[model samples]
Target: MWTTGKVIERIDWNEKLFSLRIKTDVEPFIAGQFIKLSQMRDDKRVARAYSLVNPPGCDYVEVLAVAVEDGQLSPDLKALNPGDSIEVTPKAAGFMTLDEVPKGALQGKHLWFFATGTAVGPFISMLATDEPWQRFEKVVLVYGVRLGEDLAYLDTIKQFIEQHPQQFVFIPIVTREDYPEGLSCRIPDGISSGLIEQKAGLGINAEHSQVMICGNPGMITDAQTALVEKGLVKNLRRAPGQITVEKYW
Candidate 1:
């Protein structure tokens, strides 16, 4: 289940965020899946899982990666150029896809996707799929970053919202920058102060909402606790679902 892909393009979406387009020979995959890339250095094998950002039916595979200071894979990946070959594992794995969601719960419900940093990966995948767009009456994405520059994929999300204005909502929250348009605070602060509800026009209650949380472990824990306090339960495969979470650290 391994293949080699050539780097076709590198786009600096922001100062710290970049998108890589790799030409692969494999068929398409579910939007929420990920690929494992291998880089050999010093005769040691190092690999990392990166969620795909390209739409489900695209001809090339696109992945958005953040440069972690002194990170093993990020530094090398950041330097990749077109015509370079990288090892790509074919079988993508993760439980964050729509198939893992409870069948009837997601249909005709409001979906609130909250993410921080690179954890926005899976949500990007889901948003590109027909299942989410066709099922949910409202799709609200709340992405929290350190600053305005860290808000990668803002334009992409805006494009999605622009394409389907009746169905999608994108709310960007910046903790470090004083941006005039986005929520000017942390995600938890927004939740506690009813800023989230006020902006999205939806309460935190589980009756009309389903939430997917992806971020650092601390942020996920705090967000889950805050949501639970508001009476939302964690969704599981064996049980009816309400919230799905993916931890970054």
Candidate 2:
């Protein structure tokens, strides 16, 4: 299941967030799926799952990761350089995709994407594909970050919003920013104050909306609980689905 790839580029978006583009021979995977990357030393292999940020059909795979100060994989990952080869697992896994949504539920309905840190990876993947363009009437992305500098993909997301003026809404929230523009207090605050509803114009009602959430455990849990309190349910493969969630941590 593991393959090798050379690091093609390392993008420093901020002091805490970085992205790596790896050149690999593996085939593309769905937008919301993740790949496990490994490195071998001595007799042991260390690996971690990272959501692919590149859209399907790209020649290279890109992964965005936030570096926790003393985290195991991140500090080393952030130090990678071009031409350095890293082990990558071929198989991609996760259920947080459009395919998991009920057959007709997403069609002509508003799709709300909630994310924090690297969780924006999959949503960016979904936005690049024709899936969101053709299936949903509207797409609202609420990305929460600790500081304004942590909003790494805002430029890309803004460009997408500009290009698809009628299709998508991009909202970036900074929890620790003092005077952030185009930023709100937090995801939960946005939801409770009806700011998210006002921006999406779909309200928080379950009938016309389907939400996909990804992020740290606490953020994901809190967001999911808030959505459920507003009447959303977890999507399951067996019964066929509502909200899809993937926890980065």
Candidate 3:
């Protein structure tokens, strides 16, 4: 289930975030799915799940990760270089895939994606694909970070926004370091407080909307509770609902 791939590129997304582009011949994966990557440590296989940042079927699998200072995997991941061998699990994982969430237009609903930190990985893949734009009347992506420096994929998201203009919305939320552009607040606060909807001009209604959340445990829990209070429920394979979650951290 695990295969070795060379790190084709190592990106310094920011001081806090770094990424790896692994060239592999694995099966195609869904946009919001994740893969386990590992390296040998103390004679044991140490792995961590990382959401794929690129669209499915790309020649390279891209993973966006926030370097956890003094953490188990961060040291090794950050130390990777081009041509460095990394153990990549071939089987893609995670329920964050779009197939598990609610559809739009046909179902008369909107789709919202909330992400923070490196959690932006999966959302970027989803937004790049044609399925979302075709299925949703409107799609809003709320990306939250601690400071303006943490803002990422601006060009990529901007290009997608330009192409879809009317149907896709991109909002960045920064909780620290006063930024004149992006709204400043926690993602759940932005939603429960209505500031995010106000900026997008499209209300997030539990009745006619489905939300996908990916981030740290705290953010995911808070956002889920807020959405549930608004009449949304977590989608299950046996019992479908209006919300889906995948903890990226």
Highest lDDT model number: 3
Please provide, for model 1 over 152-189, each residue's C-alpha lDDT reduced to its tens digit, 9 standing for 90 to 100: 77777888888889989888888876877889877877
Give candidate 2's error at residue 94 in angstroms. 1.4
Off by over 4 Å in 2: 105-108
lDDT, candidate 2, equals: 0.81
Model 3 clash pairs are none
Worst 10 residues of 2 by lDDT: 177-186
TM-scores for all candidates: the values are 0.94, 0.93, 0.95
Model 3 lDDT, full chain set: 0.85
lDDT (C-alpha, whole model) for all candidates: 0.81, 0.81, 0.85
lDDT of 3 by residue, 33-82 (tens): 88999978899988898889899869889988877887788778998999
Off by more than 4 A, model 3 = 103-106
lDDT of 1 at 200: 89
Give candidate 2's error at residue 158 in angstroms. Answer: 2.2
lDDT measured at residue 246 in model 2 versus the true structure, 0 to 100: 86
| Top TM-score model | 3
Candidate 3 positional error at 213, Å: 0.4
